[model samples]
Target: MYSGIGDHGERAAFLDARALIGCRHRLLLDSTHPRVLTGVSEDAGVQQRREAAAAHRMLVRDTLVAADPERWLVIAPEQTAAQRAAETMAAMEAGIERIWGGLLPQELDTGRRGGCEILRRDPDRGGYVPIIVVNHKVTDPRQPDPADFHPLTTELYTWNPKPDKHVRNRPQPRDQQRLAHLYRMLQRHGYASPALVGGAIGYHFDRVLLHDLGPILDDYDRRYADRIAVVRGELPTVPSKVPECRQCPWWSRAPEEGGQSCEQWLVGRRDISLVAPGSRAEVLRRHGVETIDDLAAWEGDDPDDWQYEPFTEAIVTARAWATGAPLVRRVDRVQVTRADVEVDVDLESYQEHGAYLWGTLLDGVYRGFVTWDPLPTRDEGRSFAEFWSWLMEIRAQAAADGKTFAAYCYSRTAEDKWLYESARRFAGMPGIPTEREIQRFVDSPQWVDMFQAVSEQFICPNGKGLKKIAPVAGFSWRDPEAGGEASMSWYRLAVAYEGGEPDLSQRTRILEYNEDDVLATQVLRDWMTDRADAEVPAISDFGRRSIAE
Candidate 1:
């Protein structure tokens, strides 16, 4: 059991007990059930990641045991070997040493100094650099900095699900802001060693860090002094209308069964985000307005005021929340092109890898193209090609028959972004469409973004995401924990080829998730069409192929 331990897997930088209080305090404080930290879900994706973490820890422990079998006798005598391995890895993952120095690794001498989980000794800098492992590709990295981390750190290490694939070398601007602070802190502390970043793409090492520790580190000290307040929760914990709030654990159901929800306490406080993100919410708050009723009292029927739309939405949402009903505002109708035969599309992608699955619904059946191989390969291109050909063929058939056809995606920006990016990466592939074709298709009236469509017509109270909109439209996912985050976890499991080949059940869950995503769009379309002045019925022929109920 010990000799054949597998490699430690890639997980998010913060996923333990310490991080809950340190970096993510706002979310944790809002959580009604603290047990969410340890509750195990039956979600296939969650289970897959849990398995990966355990396997990776076992591998690391095996390596430690193999190196010095007798070392643990002195290092951890009271606990069994298994207990020591698990606890140590947990400590390493959480950077507990920065807080408590008791459980430092005895065998690894040069590592785990100055706050970073030691990757290795830095030959160039003479001191160690901190390492951070993220679950996805380094694209659009958004993380709060650890102010308590050691100042001697240089470039932090980061890797994704497909570590072997180097999607891009540049860290995001926000990350650069963080690295700048870390570098400056080290210099200010008189460590003065140049910081660098390196990570493994399989066995291959890439000097992936781009920010120069020298120029950027100059102002880190002054900035970091100010930085502590931003993360320290100096600002009031008021709920905003941001998308992240919709998925925050604070709003999640109680961690334990049959307990109160984290969001239950704030039942009457209205979301100030209805107006917008900036000065508008402040204005509303200043007027002693904390609920939709306040907005109604202050509102006037001024033709020129931009607040009209917001006021209208607040009223509708307020009534629905109070009465346990759904309300659709009729004044704000949007013009969305519709056809008898329409394609409902949804794309499932991992930031580390390009779009891997494209699920489409047409002719009353769900047609999906799943790319199993890693990115920058022909595997993803095949999915694009297969979907495009079938879509164009049916579209031509509809054109000849004098019937209209169109494509409707829940979020236009998401689907269009993936389509264009995939075209750019796999331009030379035979099955894929050209960038020009994709651009033309996007511009065409046949392509509809349901998000924009919904926003133009009605203002939803809860959120505008498919998870909220689809349920109201009478669509539900076939599987539990059928969220984007959960799907990514499932994807990792679906593609696992190391310990054992993936079985049918693993792949089936992923397919079902994608299929459900596309079907939800169909439901939304039909609902909207029904609400339109003239009804256009969507296809009733949900194809023969269906996800297991």
Candidate 2:
């Protein structure tokens, strides 16, 4: 579901487990429509993640096999679906302790067929259950009393047996939902364990995450029914703009290129979803505000007493989108925090790996501290320490000159996370700041998040991302394809992430991208301070104009 995957050249013969978690429009397209490859290619970050997950699964399988070779039945990828199912069934019938990479028998009634990462026989319940191995981290040591299971044995424990393991507050809903789907498939084949539970082995492969299947199955049933309804024409298969559109194969090029893209279709209709999310668009449609033009022309007064607090904000955003304005002011006067000695900062990293590049812009000069080594290496600390030292020197010099100082980033969340993380990870290293020092700097007024300022002071119709908003400030990256995703792709080539000869030119490309990012932040901050009040239309202007109309 997350990957937007389906069979090519055929109407969906079966709904996979992913169908329980992803976009409905995507599912419908994948089910009913022939595949159309577009400009949306998988970025290096996604490819790296997929490879990492595959590696983790192999490591776990190897570890299990090394411990007890006889108790495991490993299904070969070379086997056809029929062959896999037969082999899996034979293993289950023989009470094999574990079946690695098993393809479950298809359920003819529901048309659901999929492969399971691991199918473990239950000693207590007399049948098999599903266990998934994933790349993402499932839990952290933030809270107590997490549901834990033995990584190798698949024995579950409600409380954490280890002190440094806890359940994350945020749930992994996709993992749970997929497990529920697989559990139903197991039940159909009459091989489901009566225990009503499933397991997930995440990036931290030391333990398995145990999930109770009771509530998860209930939710899965509802989602599966809805998807099946949409497939059977019991529901509308209307396309809406969603975050998932980025990964969808059915999504095509711009409408002006004579391509039949979902985005182009929405643009032609001036669809509400073009300016608002799917849920919000549905709400506006219910109120008879069906298009961006209609929304822009709407008065603040609600005829039906909907009491929607965001009604005026939505209308203003629509107006901005319709008029092709970068932003419409949500406040009376634009306010931006500025300083005499200002620095714009940007960091580049490869996926969830350590930050390898720290680019800074100060006094019309760009400086970059970068490491060429592949990530998750000791060398990351050297670059991080050098960047920190340089930044501190600038800050101290400014203080000595009696100049007020401020460091700016488009978004502080990423920078702040890496700042503390780097400090902690390399505490004993030369020139590395302590966590306390990092916290003091982050908490001080000198650290400013320009993204927060923009979000608070303006209504950005398109997006609040630096790439989107920086252009409004007359700033553009030299690289036409400059973006975080593009930078990750460049970083991979620059560092030889997958064991090939490194492309040194890609390193130059990444530095240029990082420089542009920091420059964009600086440009955006300057625009907010010097020109935003005179240039952007305020909310009051809309109100007065509406009264005149």
Candidate 3:
């Protein structure tokens, strides 16, 4: 099984654990068009995440080694994969308790080569189990359960384990499948642990989150097999529009060998995937409706035959796309909730660290409640409290004067999440409101989500994002490069998260970006109220069909 084990050599970095979780077309590109993938550089956000994850792995390794100095062996990065694998084998044979940064022998049969963050020697099984340390949370604090874990030792409490673990109800398929990949490699090298389980040390290094590999083995096998097929040209790589396309390296780059970019290829063919959900698009393709033109021109009455219901919206969107229209009004007359006193609000955070800035616009004047301190700081509460208190005061004053009052945000998801989170985290802090008060404010009709309003009354052919829709309302940001992703990079620089002199200019840029965001919501609400009827085309004008339930 180990013959020519390292012949696959160093596997491309792109084909790592993410290949199983990310877009398959990207995997194919990584194998065949590696030059194209390499041409694309990592953005600031991606860089920040990579750094944070690396830092987390180091911390976990250090903690484990500190606890049991004699038992832990760390494989040096300077060695070749074969040398590291041999060293790892010797350590395992010698019965080392834990191995850090140990590269496993390649699974040449599948062209898989990689290393685990830590290979924990299973005392009962006589082999090592893989453990990955990541920056993101694996468990949900919101849904607490009896967790079974060894906090300081970073081991799983298997038998008679305490039921104190709170597993995230949401599936973390990426992490699970990754463990399966490593498990397969271990098996190939005759290092397979009898216990078909792996662990992940997430942001809350309080305990290792254990996962049984049995359930995900079949799934991982299928995904890996299919990806290998595509890589070997046994299967074709078909490009389809997906949410991941937004971050895909090949999304816009034209191949040096002369071929249309992924974006160009999709748009040129007027691919149905561009205008419809992936599942719906696949169903549409099976029904001989492969392109947006086919979808727009399709006149079939019973969409039930296509095996996907409620297909009217996609058809309408395709028609709008064909007509070069940004949006089509669903309602005969667009309406917006108006108030004598109103505030447009926007929040900015530094990549899950915490919300650091709350920008609000009222009466054409912008007031920014900002924390200059780095995030995950107690000062986040100060900024949030200041913003909330000021807004509440405005509402109270408006009520005292018998004037209607409302607060508008582009989307309530991000804002509402942070609001409740801040209240809960800073419960006892001065100026912080109770969770109930935050809920009351969010639940109230006066808290308007303009994005929801837009969704209810319009069919945006392009997209419904603030940046995408705001231009239609005659609103634009002062900074040419202003965007949510761009702001992540700016925030990193502004705060100097990677250790450097903080760039004050980036702070100014972030403030301007936030101001524009609030201003966009204000203008959008105004546009929907005053000019939507005249400016936006009615859905009825586009040969509207009956929508199925």
Winning model by lDDT: 3
Better candidate number, 2 or 3, judged by lDDT: 3
Q: List model 1 lDDT by residue over 265-310, tens digit each.
A: 3453544444333345555566665655455444454223345454
Residue-wise lDDT of candidate 3 within 56-166, one digit each (tens)?
Answer: 788888887887778779999899878998898888778787889988765555667678888887777668788888788776554543454422123432322233344
TM-score to native of every candidate shown: 0.61, 0.88, 0.90
**Global lDDT of each model?**
0.52, 0.79, 0.80
Q: Which ten residues in a row have the lowest lDDT in candidate 2?
A: 150-159
What digit string (tens of lDDT, one per residue) describes model 2 on residues 90-192?
9888888888999987655566778888898877777887989887777654434447532222333222322334445237898888889988988987888
Superior by lDDT: candidate 1 or candidate 2: 2
lDDT of model 3 at residue 223?
Answer: 91
Instruction: List pairs with backbone clashes in candidate 3.
Output: 146-163, 146-164, 146-165, 147-163, 147-164, 147-165
Q: lDDT winner between 1 and 3, please give it.
A: 3
RMSD of each: 12.2, 4.3, 4.1
